[model samples]
Target: MAEVHTVYVPRDTTACSLGAEAIAQQLGRHLAMHSPDCRLVRNGSRGAFWLEPLLEVETEQGRLAYGPVTPEQLPDLLAAGLLAGTTEHPLYLGPVDDIPWLRRQQRLTFARAGVTDPLSIEDYRTHGGFVGLKKALSMTPQALVDEVKASGLRGRGGAAFPAGIKWQTVLDAPADNPGNPQSGRKFIVCNADEGDSGTFADRLVMEADPYMLIEGMIIAGLAVGADYGFIYLRSEYPLAHQVLQEAITRAEQAGWLGADMQGSGRDFQLEVRLGAGAYICGEETSLLDSLEGKRGMVRAKPPLPALKGAFGQPTVVNNVLTLAAVPWIIDQGGQAYANHGQGRSLGTMPFQLAGNIERGGLVELAFGPTLRELVEDFGGGTRSGRPMQAIQVGGPLGAYLPAAQWDTSLDYEAFAEAGAVLGHGGVVVFDDTVDMAQQARFAMEFCMVESCGKCTPCRIGSVRGVEVIDRIIADDNRAAQLDLLAELCDTMEFGSLCAMGGMTPNPVRSAVEHFPDAFGVTPESSAGAA
Candidate 1:
């Protein structure tokens, strides 16, 4: 009998979308007939999307990889000694870790992604999964909050607000549970409603390593004295929803969740609620409203979510990446995590590269790298193989950075200084064929379509913005239209209710300022508009 070997097939959304299921089925049937003893394991993607449906075979040396695999190629792969982990195959990518693309990433939060069977608790534990939660259980709540503060972790949901500060706010705010005065109810809401364009890290995290998020939320519950938690997930992520549900159930069964957390005498409960595809629900307040079965709309702040959130109780609302980073912070010590990046932007970010880029995938690196490095080095330039035009660093609402600004560091403050943002670490590249005018129009058009319609600026200003851009493009009173557009942007920026209206001008202004030619703004016309 031949020795049994383990074969890994990624079950991540990206992998499955690219036919990993078919590849897995093909491999399974082939293995049953030729090598019945071989074990097939479904794992999560390693964030190397260019190699989706990536297959790995465990050998005495290490896990050797073959990728972009298809069902049609299975017979040849098998014949080439794929079960024997042969390197002679053209698709063989050597040791998985040694692959330069995977090797260079600073994968802290995603340490276990793609490496373990996502549903297996034992696999998660074996690879140092619950170490942070265990360590967090031993510390005082304040101590844990202090550790997070020391780490300088910020909200990855675009605001870049310090996570530690928010945690401390929730920790200090008195829970407003009148019925249970002695043990008040505080809530931890994980904002998994990732609606930003060119962003999928949140979904990847949830589907690939559900337990990491679950463990992070549990630690947050402990840190802030929150007894209940809810993950407000977007409706598009059905796979993530299924995976999270299963992971939560397994967590409850394993004593990591439910009435008594690992017998520590602390109580924490968690549940997942689906969002109805409202882009505004990505906003924390709107998310809370949607979670409460109300129409998703932004709430005025001053009664911050920390003071009064879901159901009029103090709630700690954090983005998926923000919370998912907690367990690592607690286990490694805050300063250890802080030591990775420069300035106020501490630690690594899982930067998602998309849009007209070759080798597009997730690159987790420290915050100081320039956008050029990320786009050129890791992304391998534009997919069109043409001269690059614009680079949108943050999201749809983020600035359309011209080549001059591409050298700016990826830090939050640095990007702000350069009139750009590091919102959610989503870098979308565009080739020279892109029309900046159309792209700018799409920004307003998107705001118009996705706006919650609670505020006039976001709702009406966006509509006016689309009209003004069209007039300018048609060369109808170009200078005056440009001026009108600028003023409207100002009104939306200052008078609007939330970032939904305020940040809409970022892309519009950036396109006009950087690519004035595209907007039909000549030197004389620009001077007149100014």
Candidate 2:
């Protein structure tokens, strides 16, 4: 009799896009002929995307990795004793856990990612899944809220609002279900609409360790006295949609998500609602409108979502990463989670490195490392091997940071003090070849295209912004145009209804301030520069 071995090939979108499916098929045929007893497992990516289709083989020593493999290389890999987990193969990456890229930082929320079969309930449980939810069931709702608050967890979805405060608001807001005073009809909404450029953490969680998200959502539902939840997923993420829907069905069948969750008598029902590719729907209020089958548009605050949301009921609106962090807080205790980060930005941030980076992927670190460390140490500098000129933290609306600002700490307050944002933890790199003037123009153009047209500042102001930038670049009354651009940015920043219009000026102003030559003006001559 032969011992059964396991081979893991990532089925996540990144891996599949990089020919993981072809590699898997090639491996399957070879396995059947050579080692019939061995099993093939379709797992999630380890977030080291440069190494995808990263193949892992479980052995007595540890899980060994071989990566960036092509279908043509499969025969050579097998011939080099790949099935026996041989390090003799050039592609072998030693123990997966020992990789410097993965070993350096903390992985609380993503602890189980790329480790287990994403849809397997038994595998999920074996890897400490649902431990947080089980613990949450033993505690009172107030205690749960307090635990999250103590952890100092803030919204990971750009705004950085305290998650515990939002939870408390929904908890304190009386549940008004119309005819039934005791109906308790509050809702939990997970904003999975990851429309920001260079952001994929939300999609990764949904595709990799989906149960973590499901468990987190369940915990949120229990804490807020809500029996129903909806994950407002973006239409662009078809793979995430399929994985989440399947995970939900499996969780319900296993009693982790149904009316009687794990026999605890909790009645939380969850579903996924798709958004119509509108970037504005990433906003909580606009997401609610879309969830209710209306056009995606922003709603005025004061009647906050925590007070009246999702069909005129009190609601908890949090993004994927924010909710995904809950189970860890509950399972490990709030203070334990709080002990990881710096200042008010407690807990680890899964920073996504993209654009011109050499080793572009996810790097989850505590909130203290400078941008230089992330780009040079982890990212390995620019893919073009050229000098790095600027880095755009957060999304398109985030400020374009120059090399002078690279040493700034990654803390929320630190970034805020530097006139930038740590939005969604996306760090997009740019080489010296990048055109700052064109980049600034695209920021306004993007806003003009994506704005919901709900407010004058976002709709009309963005259009005017593009024209002003064009005139500035054309050198038509350069200083005067720059001054006018500054005034227009001031209007949009103060008068806009949301960050869409407000933050559009971030890149524009930063570019003009840092790289005046790109805008046809010298630093000494540029007027109204930040």
Candidate 3:
């Protein structure tokens, strides 16, 4: 007869790292002993990572939030009558979305994340979960692809290729025949191997609202005429993998995925294939190779994946964010989704603000915000309150940007024009204490460690690159070493098999170009100084 109030806590990896699991246990013990009428629900993070272990209590007013909680604070919170949803603690953050940090931006793909119980199918539908998939069920396959095309949604997994274009290719390709199993069968794969530094969007999606991804993949399968799909998740994210496995089992039982999807009589079989720890596996072709029990190496592209992929079948490979975005595009017409962001870069970007920053976390906004706004305003500047020196847009392969270039727009084309690429929307800030020369050297070192060694340029050149940078750092003929470094980067950029070696030069070159002072001389004075 008594009302059972619900409490929400995040099981997100970032939140867990901040002792959310321990905090959750303490809350459970405290609420049971003190407030027996309350229930705790472990949800995903709300993306404001700085305020992790955020607790949201259901109230007539709304879900009131209190945050960055630890196990030690649970007793005090209970003593303060926190379960009544009227706690006046200093750490309380009124309402979750009303928090200026979350309210300012757009969140399309991540609509249900941190809000719904990850594995609860009923919870998912209650919060606008299956609307996209239900919409997709009515339209013809070509019509669905066209709707996606009209949305102008590019790949969120670094390449920025149009998702509809890839789907159209697979749709046009032949379907699986009895005699030719590989040629006729089409495949849909979600590239969940989020190995990029400072990037946790993929992990967040999988861990928090996995059914959204399942729905997206099923929609993609229906559009591309594919019955089989797999989410190639990396091994590092144990929590994501476990959550995805449980979520898939739930969907299979609930008829969201399997031989008969939602009684539509259509088939979309989904599986989760774990990836080895090789960063190179994040590449689409390399991912396919790894999925097939082969050594994870880049495949030649004459016969494209659209025509021949995944055991020599026509396949559609999309990033988790790219596919997860589909449900929203379908539910809210493509034009509506298109109306949000700036220019050709349409829709919201879940920008991961990370590394040595003050208020770092995931901030999803439309594509117009400049780097300065992201680093300073949303991020609250550097944690150390030091002069912000440089920032890396995108992942490890992305270029390092100096303070002079902070005004650059976060648009993909704008970044490309400036010798940069928004590779998966990771922005890592570094203060004045950083040594550009050393950072540049680490770029090459990272490439060497992650390279599949499929090409001579990546394998051999990376070694030579480290040697040349050591020479530059030692001031042993710095002028010649600089020239050698430039030449080596050019070789790797043009000669490498994949982006692994090709884009490694992005950070190295940008560091050398922007902060010449770190290298001990300007280009104009290099020879004289040497």
Considering every candidate listed, which one attains the maximal lDDT? 2
User: Candidate 1's C-alpha lDDT?
Assistant: 0.91
Error of 3 at 516 (Å): 1.2
Off by over 4 Å in 3: 1-4, 176-183, 522-524, 527-530
Q: Which residues of candidate 1, in runs, are more than 4 Å off?
A: 1-4, 177-183, 528-530
lDDT of 1 by residue, 99-120 (tens): 8988988999888899999999
User: How do the residues 1-530 of candidate 2 rate in per-residue lDDT, one tens digit apiece?
Assistant: 12339999999999999999999998899888878889999998889987888999988877889987888898898887888888888898999999999898689888888999999999899998999999998889999999999999999999999999999999999985777543568999999999989989999999999999999999998898989999999999999999999999999998899888888888889999999889999988899999999988888887899998998899999999999999989999999989988999999999999999998888888899999999999999999999999999999889999999999999899999999999999999999999999999999999999998999999999999999999988989888888999999999999988889989999889998888889988756755554
Model 3 lDDT tens row, 1-530: 22329998899899899989998888888778877778899988878888887888887777888888887887787666677765578878897768888887688877777888888899999989889999898899999999999999999999999888988998998765556656567899899999999899999899989999999999998898888998999999999999999999999998888987888999989899999899999999999999999999999786888888898888999999998999999999889889988888988888999998988888888888899998888999988899899999889999999887889998888898888999899999999999999999999999889999999999988989989888988989988888888888999999998999999989999998888899877667765331
Clashing pairs in 1: none
Alpha-carbon lDDT, every model: 0.91, 0.91, 0.88
The residue pairs that clash in candidate 3, if any, are: 175-184, 176-184, 176-185
Q: If scored against the real structure, what TM-score would every candidate get?
A: 0.97, 0.98, 0.97
- In what order do the candidates fall by lDDT, top score first? 2, 1, 3
Clashes of each: 0, 0, 3
Clashes of 2: 0
